[model samples]
Target: MSLNRRQFTKLMVGGMASSLLPSSVLAQGTTKNNIKAIAFDGFPIFDPRPIFGLSNTLFPQQGKQLAQLWFSKIFGYTWLRTAGNHYKNFYAVIEDALIFSAESLKINLSPNDKRMLMEAWLNLKVWPDVKAALLQFKKNNIRLAFLSNFTEEMLRRNAKNSGIDDMFEFYLSTDKVQAYKPSPLAYQMGVDAFGLPKENIAFTAFAGWDAIGAKWFGYPTVWVNRLGKPIEKMGIAPDSTGKNLNQLVDFVLT
Candidate 1:
């Protein structure tokens, strides 16, 4: 849906606050066809669902029934459930949703359960194919960076656990900008980080709505639809759709 003028402005402003790029530095370097960076969102950067639910023997509902709602939000449903369940703050909403899902399932979660959940986040094992794909990108000498809403501390810990910290030029977070994806400001922050024009840098996300956000910002976007889900009804379309990061890289290089 096309946002009204007010909504657009709010999204843009929120994006800038949530991203990490310093606005003052955006004008320093060439903003032309310089393919200096390839950016990605962390969740889509790796699949965290298995790790997220690994230890849970059951699924339960709790203080908030938003986890199932969140699952539906991320993956979507065959039919529309409601119109008003839209989330404004994506990160907080996901956390609430996870906790709610755990409670609803009566999984008998404990501090250890929470610890494993948090630790699993830190140690998120990328899909079996991610390493080879990333290696290929490196072989081609393409710069890689992660632009995500994860807190800096959380990202750092996760990077180490995943064993891919050195693969990135740098890992950035929304904390620096204070906004989330599907916001032009966040995309611009990534662009500004490379000091390149929107078209020169490419971005990828597992979520179709995020792909829409990047497209709206004039960046070439790849949608990693591992499950082959349908496109989001957000109007914009991704430049390429692939089943995995490896497929996505091949598409970009081609």
Candidate 2:
């Protein structure tokens, strides 16, 4: 469906799926062909479901709760660190988050379970829609980079494990700046790496909050909402929103 900005905003906040919009409900001064390069949040490129899935398998009853808590703590720690200018690598943050989550839920996490959970990060694969969209982006001469909170080591290992490491032109992980997403310094990596005006680069976000962050940083943004979650109520919206990389590819390449 073709949704105007207000309509998209209303539906999104109402917790509705408005994916596959042929046209974007864009911010002022944003326009077509504004997308030249794409700086993607890591989750848009890497499928993280398996790690959570393993949680479900490992702790059958407490599985879902454990996964949810762990996921939230990971970002909570990142934001806390970013705010205090206390930067730590994402690998450590993920481990610390998992430990906190397990403790909060009173789940006794074995060393083996912890190891398996942490190792899952190193084995992430791309979403099914990613490779095709990437190939299309390359064909059109659109530069591609990862602008994510993930540590460079995590990003590289996952990409290399997926066998698509060569697809990226740059890896702009938060470690380079010691700041996390939603921080202007972190978002600047895209403009610096691509050597393009901020308006000329498209930022693809996997989470609603990241969409708000990229938009605030002055990039035309796309939210790749694979799970069809509601946009965060931050009074900010992405320039375009879609369900998968193919829809994002259409937004950029069309």
Top TM-score: which candidate number?
Answer: 2
lDDT of 2 by residue, 1-254 (tens): 78999998897875544343323333112435667788989999999999989999999999999999999999999999999999999999999999999999999999999999999998999998888889877776678899999888888999998788998999889999999999999999999999999988999999999999999999989999998999899888898899988778777876
lDDT of 2 at 26: 31
Each candidate structure's TM-score, on Cα atoms with residue i matched to residue i, is 0.70, 0.86
lDDT of each: 0.65, 0.89
Residue 6 C-alpha lDDT in model 2? 98
lDDT value, residue 203 of candidate 2: 92
Q: What does the lDDT read for residue 196 in candidate 2?
A: 95
Give candidate 2's whole-model lDDT. 0.89
**Compared with the true structure, what per-residue lDDT tens digits does model 1 show for residues 184-214?**
6567777777776777778888777778878
Model 2 clash pairs are none
Clashes of each: 17, 0
Clashes of 1: 17
